[model samples]
Target: MFKIKSLVFIFLVFYSTINYAQFTDVINSNRPGQSMAAFSVGKTVIQAELGINRIIEKDKDVDYKAAIWNSDLALRYGVFFEQFELIANLEYQNEKFTAPGVDIHEGALKKVLIGAKYLIYDPEKNYEKKPNLYSWKANHKFNWRQFIPAVGIYGGVNANLAKNKFLRGSDIPRDEDFTLKGMILTQNQFGRYTFLTNIILDKFPSQRNSIDYVLTMTRGFNDRVSGFLEIQGFNNEFYKDHFLRTGAAYLVRQNIQVDASVASNFQASPNIVFAGVGASWRFDANYNEVMLRVPKEEKNDGKSKKEKKDKEKKDKEKKKRKDAVENTEFK
Candidate 1:
């Protein structure tokens, strides 16, 4: 039985010197968390990740409490090449606010983003980490090279539509209809553990100018299950907070996965908590495997042309003599 590992982030097959592997035997998904993976789906493959969350927030300073429900969807397609992916994300939220003798409800599209990610460097490229057949200790020993992670760059445009109350908080400005977002993604996998990190700059050149980071660690328990813990930090002119999330994912099939996670911020002024469930599916019916070919080169052993000719002549004469002997025997 083949176990599906934590395919959350970068896992690549390097062929020749210019290849980064795309796709896998099973679907690779970045879900139950907010970070993106460094590897793209296979060329011509399309994938969808969808989730819904229940969020609760309490603000002592503002003297308000809220309950929110949100649904998010991401569509990813491999385009142009295996190292590149185009993605679109959409989120919708419904909220209810309660205070001293006050009740309010709101609903809107919280997010609309279109992005592209490209893998710039893959540590596993042109390198294979072979297991030591004789020494188990050598196989288990820590290798310093795992510190080198695969790197990717992402850039996107966020469309802040009207009536999106979530994006237009009291502290945030709504002057910008569109903002540019960029992120740096990195991932490392060794043994059963995989580590991923993302550094993001959102709403760039805008008043909010948010800076965010996510760190995640995932471990594979068996062929069908994987668990992950993640931490995210957000900083901007208006607010700052840290959040922790933990979750497990189950592989339902080679092309489908289901996951659930709980998250909470480590703060008091305005505390927040959320729980979510998600699923990812991939369609790869049009994908064709790409392989590298190396041209065969003729070998030269420094044999003289006259020596080759003499050998050929002797072989022909020997064949002739054998034929002559056969003819005489027949006669």
Candidate 2:
């Protein structure tokens, strides 16, 4: 079943790429510019991203180059429920440049995602344990004690707006552009540590189509630490790119978590060498949480007061038992 799904995803991506090729000449010749904004809200996660790219060329200009700028922001919230969970994300970005005294401005509402996930085919089963990459202790392992494969899909739509101008001898025409986009993402996860994949598809106002695939692996190290790695593939007639990112998170307390990651793109654009420190704290409800502490503080204090109290209680009980046994033996 997994193989079938993977093959279908690949085929769809290729099909979309072919369709986009038919418009390559039209898009390239006119120096058409594009900007994208995307937002996703799911049962357990929320994210937003914005990107813009433009090609600058005018009549009788031989030294023409393409200028591009992109920015992305995302947030994830976890919810476990039988019905469905809500997720929200927001993203923003701006891209602009000029050549030969010609000014250009191109931007988009990159992301606005909101959706949910439903539980399906949640079977009760157990399987052997496996090793995880983020395991802190050498001997720690986790078994697939509970098996629940859920099937739910999510999707959203957004708008894109841009403006550009060209100056030439005070007698040139200015260009204005506008676009609308619709996007969808379907995600599925099996067991506690099995195959995870997401299928993303989008349609632009220029009638351009895009399809992407993202695969991820998550491993739990003990109960407080976890690690994940994600690989993404974007296929379109104009460009094809791949990205790989690795990250780890530690539960600093009952309602707080700290995470950091390193990401890189396998393209010539830019190898993103960045590390961020983030934290979350829950006040009333788990979903109503905010980022409070820094990475350093969250990393140092993952255990809560309740957890410490339970440990102390266990220790006292053990000591009392030992004392009672000694007294009986002496008597």
Candidate 3:
């Protein structure tokens, strides 16, 4: 136990020592989407987000009612040497009855997730500044969503860590069993309007025949505010459940964001609802310097970053050979 604690401490120290190189997690996110930003959070960046929500449900007879306080947390680390990210998730749930004389009251750690994402493909493409030439309606302004989109693909897994006490009758988290997920992400900009989309597929080991799909769309109002709408459910099976959610988020500069959302299980009994508020903060040893100095799309003349990197490598090699020849003559 002591060794485990010590190792965690060391890992955090290393995480914080990094720099803030990319955007924080998307706003108004109920679940982690597969949309990878075109750029990696530079090696020195560390990001975290926290969500808190209240759930209300009543028995059909209206005698028993339960209110649960659920908290969701996620932390991400950037390994800038490669287009890779490491993330961890922790969830805590507090349950109680608002009504008087109810014996059921419990709150404990419910779930944990540890995963990694590698950017396999990123078309570092940018849109030229253009006007919203709306021809259909008289006053419809154009936006970034009208342009061709840049795509990013990522894959990861969420490990299940449910305490035996937290798993009993009528209580199970959606991420209960070990699940593997793959995501396709894309987005385009219309002026200050950014539309990000994600298509996700989740597979459960215990239920090999079952797969879940989560499709999400995020609209950005500006650099500081954004909103989202989503539809998530099961696909191709005997059982199908569909859910809808909407929310908004406000950014505190480039490193901090606060958001809120409300949702519900449409077919649930007694008409229960879910509402939540959360915030995410990104920090690194060098947030101020990088956030202010470097733009995410560096040199967007249709030349990808990898091409520029190869050019630099060749230039250095040529310089090294020239220097070696001069030294040989001098010797």
For each candidate in turn, the TM-score is 0.80, 0.45, 0.60
Q: What stretches of model 2 exceed 4 Å from their correct place?
A: 1-81, 94-109, 124-148, 161-194, 204-206, 269-277, 280-331
Model 3 clash pairs are 18-44, 19-44, 19-45, 132-142, 143-190, 144-189, 144-190
Which of 1 and 3 is the better model by lDDT? 1
Query: For residues 143-176, could you state the per-residue lDDT of candidate 1 as single tens digits?
Result: 8897898899999998887444654255456537
Best candidate, TM-score: 1
User: Any idea what lDDT model 2 has?
Assistant: 0.37
The lDDT of model 1 is: 0.76
- The digit string of per-residue lDDT tens for model 2 on 33-123 reads 0111111121233222111222222222432222433333333333553224343334343435445665567555444444443333222
lDDT of each: 0.76, 0.37, 0.52
Q: How should the candidates be ordered by lDDT, best one leading? A: 1, 3, 2
Q: What is the C-alpha RMSD of each candidate to the true structure, in Å?
A: 7.7, 16.2, 11.9
